[model samples]
Target: MGTVYQINKGLNRPISFKGLKAQYIAYLSAGLVVLLLGFTVGYILGLPLVVLLPATGLLGGGLFVGVNFLSKRFGRYGLMKYLASRRVPVYLWFNSRKLFTQLKIGEGYGKK
Candidate 1:
């Protein structure tokens, strides 16, 4: 229903935000959006702005910093490789194959 599979989807994109490229911008944006949403919800619920804002700010800022750290440590492609390496290897490449069978009465390989 919604992009159930992706084949060869990885692309090394350029810096789109203040030298942040590829997944870095996405991580930063997601962290900021989360912070904004949390702040908005606290405001709508009439929570004490003094306490709520700082708490949410710390949470969001932590997320942003953590993501930024990972991005710098792994870069675009290395991070992908690191994540992918965690998964089980489901494929092994091999070469050469043949199917052989003796013909029977009124039967052939393709006929059946």
Candidate 2:
């Protein structure tokens, strides 16, 4: 038999599943797990299957849709970048230029 090598088309690429990408896959999985636990807890607490079933189904549907939407809307790293950008202030508030004026070019910190 001749040697056959399988090619890895997804090498160095973000993990994707059924239209969800990267961290969004984790998000969807976590959400589903939470839903599953909630369903189990409710069922153990004597809640009606009628109520638990529909609630779990609706929340699971929402989780899938939301995660897929975020993956498409934000790409792989866009969501993280967007979240990081939100931490930045819109404008820097400076009362004086003393902080900038004290900087000596090419000088390391604490060097007199």
Candidate 3:
């Protein structure tokens, strides 16, 4: 059996399902925004839409890679701190205590 927990931020408590849905929606919105901006810029510059497509693809790919690299380098604590400060709800598979314990063990053994 799995348990779900609600994430609270100050006076606002967004339902966990809502937060998850919002995150996906945000990603979709970002992609759409990028595409629209690229199209607009390309039109203004008299560039072919085909060229803009590749440029947008490259930019989005690079951004995704960079974000992943940074997140990997920073680890969970860094990500948690960042999310908490930004008032974003973080959903985890386990409770904080178990998560921290696993993190410590993994860090200790995995370090070179």
Candidate 4:
């Protein structure tokens, strides 16, 4: 889960993410290891040309997907709010408790 934020109406929303921090860090670390292996193999095999480009491209593509997934999952709250705001029924859930309590309190005060 990503950070939770309260909207202006005081309702909490949760953010989701694809990979956790540690897993992401570990994935990058493994990519670095693969990159180093690619470089070393190229150096030892004297094939200076062919392998490096493909290796880098593969590693880069993996990182791109990982980052994109993370952002989309974690950044969804604004979208959720937009969806909720567009529907009156959705917004009412957030306000119903407060509205009911206020009404009850007003009725009691008036009775006194």
Best model number under lDDT = 2
Off by over 4 Å in 4: 1-20, 67-112
User: lDDT value for candidate 2?
Assistant: 0.89
TM-score of each predicted structure versus truth = 0.60, 0.75, 0.37, 0.35
Off by over 4 Å in 3: 1-38, 76-112
Which runs in model 2 stand beyond 4 Å of their true positions? 1-7, 92-112
Residues 9-65, candidate 2, lDDT per residue (tens digit)? 667988777888899989988999999999999999999999999999999999888
Which candidate order results from sorting by lDDT in descending order? 2, 1, 4, 3
Residues 16-72, model 4: lDDT tens digits: 234433244455567678777877788778875576778777877887677556545
Q: What is the C-alpha RMSD of each candidate to the true structure, in Å?
A: 12.4, 5.6, 14.5, 14.0
Which pairs of residues collide in model 3?
none
Would you list the clashing residue pairs of candidate 4? Answer: none
Q: What TM-score quantifies how close candidate 3 is to the native fold?
A: 0.37
CA lDDT of each candidate?
0.74, 0.89, 0.60, 0.61
lDDT of 3 by residue, 7-99 (tens): 564464322232233233344458668777877888899998788878888877775665555445554356556767567445533445765
Span of 10 residues, lowest total lDDT, candidate 3: 13-22
RMSD of 2: 5.6
Q: Model 2 TM-score?
A: 0.75
